[model samples]
Target: MDAKTFKVEDTKNGTDHMLPMSDVLHALFLQRHNDTGEEQYVFRREGKKGHLVDVRDSVKKVRDKSDLSFTVHDLRRSFITCAEGLDISPYTLKKLLNHKATGDVTSGYLVITAERLRAAMQQITDAILQHAEIEKTTLIQRDNL
Candidate 1:
């Protein structure tokens, strides 16, 4: 993974993609990197794959503890809903979700940059944080990036 982007090797479409990290995510990743040292995978395990392949058990544990029932796809849906509610451009949202334009001529002509995606990501993050009542002052400011 790069400092600003996280690479997804096993995507649903079997194609790799790089996702720009939001400010909060970037900070969290940096902290994790510092604690774990340089490793091939961010979330490692002593398994055959040498990394976490399935998180169902972990999710179940969290659900058991917190009584919050949600699948990983729910989080993705929430993100899309949030981005739509914010009126984020469709192309940007598609890029963030790593979805192909799929015969959209205009989308084919568009080239969304990492910087633009980062800004959009930060906006989405800020919106989510705000909805969660997290204090803005406590977060890493977007200008700092």
Candidate 2:
């Protein structure tokens, strides 16, 4: 929430991550924050501290509404594939996804910058929008600006 960035203080992997929110995600987060920022999790069950463990029902509802048959993991794979299509460096994409680089020697020296990750994320977002036939909106923050 610092300026245009969002901080993930803790994760299941026991690591904290910070990401600059793309405009579309920022708007979605803003709406969620306004609706339920008081809760511990953005999409938590009512009266629960933990997030909704099983979003299958909700995902099904969305899938039914959109008439798109896909599991939640499909969305993750689509994001990764689109980002890869842009020729985003594997290291950058891995960093964006919070994956540990174990065997790569150069990854030990390369520091992935927020700017680079933001650019990669934007590319992925743009690709998704294009694929979905959604018009690009000014809601997404651009680094060029």
| Candidate 2 lDDT over residue span 1-145, tens digit each | 4455676656557898887777677676766666785775667765667776677888988999889899867987888889888999999988887788898899999988888888888788878888888765533334311
Tell me the tens digit of each residue's lDDT in model 1 across 25-118.
Answer: 8876776666566666776664444666778887898899889999999999999999999999999999999898898999988889999999
Which residues of candidate 2, in runs, are more than 4 Å off? 7-16, 47-50, 136-145
CA RMSD (A), model 2: 5.1
lDDT of 2 at 37: 56
Name model 1 segments beyond 4 Å from true. 46-49, 136-145
Top TM-score hit: 1
Question: Against the true structure, candidate 1 has what lDDT?
Answer: 0.83
Per-candidate TM-score against the hidden true structure? 0.85, 0.77
